[model samples]
Target: MTISTNSLMSLREYFSNQQILICFNGPISTNLIGEIGSALKEHIESNHAPELEVMDVFSVYIEMSQNIRNYATSHGFSDSESSATVVIAAAEAGHYAVCAGNLVEMGDGQALLERIHELAACDKAQLKLLYKQQLRQPHTQTPGQGAGLGLIEIARRSSQPMEASLDPLEPGRAFFSLRAII
Candidate 1:
């Protein structure tokens, strides 16, 4: 099934039984991702979840947030001045999901969606090879953004393949929603 592109709140009702490990959005940067990761790590520790489980959530969140940072900077998306909104939340059933939405040029959406579809169809071994190959390839200079290996990385890290959707906002811009679950 395709991943839900809707807001997380619409995905399900919050549970009293489950703790919100972390949630934040606005201006993605390496520092912001690190800070959120640190906070979630603390939350997980206090909640007494297993160390491995906490580490998994922390790692995945960092990667997804970093992707948002890259995409926003490449697209020049600024809220106040230089702020992007990205959310990472830990849920029940040992699930941790990261969602990042941003404004992207229409041209960029097609390549990203194709990559998502390609990643979703690949097996683990193929994904590993593709990741390595991408790292080795010459970088192409796109007009508005860097080439997207981040989405592939997210798909590789996820227990399930990454999910993404595009919503048209205007003539030349669209809202891109990406989610990875670990």
Candidate 2:
């Protein structure tokens, strides 16, 4: 098998057209998350993004990446199942879009997508209330189960409603993707 140069160039051109600043697709470890987070921070800063915006982007990226890592680990997924795709891109009017996806059990992905849709339908004040309510809830001891406050926090920080989808793969599994614009 031979790799086509034109195909590689087209891939690069696609990213450039989409204004994707950073993209990673593979198994993600804790250390890799930190490294990518650092690069993301530097990239945003160098672009003269406001301090708050930078923090929000970094925070959301960490939360999303960590959730994928923890979920994969808790479910005892193999490396292939554990692989994740993350992208940070420039959006309209100086906003940045942080998107991530990973493989998940079909049921789990559907449940998560439902929750995200609920959050997306909420107004800012409603989200703030939900955030506080989630904060007051007791934390779960399960590895992949937290108070679920991260989702609320991400919603609160987003300039627009968060978006999510679950694409069916083979039986019992799907690809779960989320997008948060800030």
Candidate 3:
């Protein structure tokens, strides 16, 4: 499906019976994450949905947002530059999906794809173990930015395997998109 960029700009798009799109931009700050998290929690609760589902959304949202924050710092993606956007939208499948796209060095795309492919193949049990292992590893963050544990946590929580793509932007930069459904 052709997902329009504008569809992700407003949370209203995700509020209906089948979907809700929660989108954010730029460098992620703690305050912004809290606000976004609260808004999503309130959105789910306002619908009178089960607390379980709301918690699911909350957990997934935190992971996705943190990914964006890390990407900004790791890849030098700035919010004002229009090179990064993070979106969390609920779908008809009864799952909430998180998607983040940002600019990165073209050289990193291949390695990122390889990492995503590895995570996608891992089962939940394996993902949980990986999350714990990665968490314990000293945060050897790369040059620009990254916390490094977000993906393992995402894989652990997502109902399905994580999905990602690297699209070319410029000669030296590419757009990386990652999605997970919970």
Candidate 4:
């Protein structure tokens, strides 16, 4: 496959319509995450975003990307399965949205989606309590297991409720996507 010029143009048009400022799709490494994260910070600063909002967006992006990287590494996924698609877009009312997606085992995706839904239902105070609770728990023994604080933090920082979806892919895998508006 060769992508024709028309197809490329169409993709660009779609991104523009969505107000996407940055997008990356592939296997993410620590170095790549850092590089992209720096770019994101610069973009936010240049746009004159508030300092607190800029920090929130940067932190959320790092947390989400690291989660994807760790999940893929711990699960022994192939490169294609480990690859992630991350996007930062401008939302209405001067808000920004960070979205991420990757293929995951169907079961794992469902569990994560459920957790996200639970977090989404919570009010800000509830999320704060949850975050504090998670922070107090000892880290899981497993190398890649999380205490779920990252999800709670994301929810607390978001201006709107977080959203997540799973799209069935192969028999045992699905594409899990999450969007957080800040």
Highest lDDT model number: 2
Instruction: Provide TM-scores for the models.
Output: 0.74, 0.96, 0.76, 0.96
Which tens-of-lDDT digit does each residue in 58-120 have in candidate 3?
887787666656666655556653345777777646677777776777777668778889999
Off by over 4 Å in 3: 1-18, 25-29, 74-79, 141-147
Error of 2 at 118 (Å): 0.8
Report the Cα lDDT for residue 9, model 2. 94
Query: TM-score of predicted model 4?
Result: 0.96
For residues 115-139, write the lDDT of model 1, one tens digit per residue.
7888899988998888899889878
Superior by TM-score: candidate 1 or candidate 4? 4
| lDDT comparison, 1 vs 3, better candidate | 3
Q: Give the distance in Å from residue 121's predicted Cα in candidate 2 to where it truly belongs.
A: 1.0
The lDDT values for all models are 0.70, 0.93, 0.73, 0.92
Off by over 4 Å in 1: 1-20, 48-52, 80-83, 139-148
Model 3 CA lDDT for position 178? 86
lDDT of 2 by residue, 11-69 (tens): 89999999999999999999999999999999999989889999999999999999999
On a 0 to 100 scale, what is the lDDT of residue 28 in model 2?
97
Model 4 per-residue lDDT tens digits across residues 12-130: 99999999999999999999999999999999999898999999999999999999999899999888878999999999899999999988889889999999989989999999999
Error of 4 at 125 (Å): 0.4
Query: Highest TM-score among the candidates is held by which one?
Result: 2
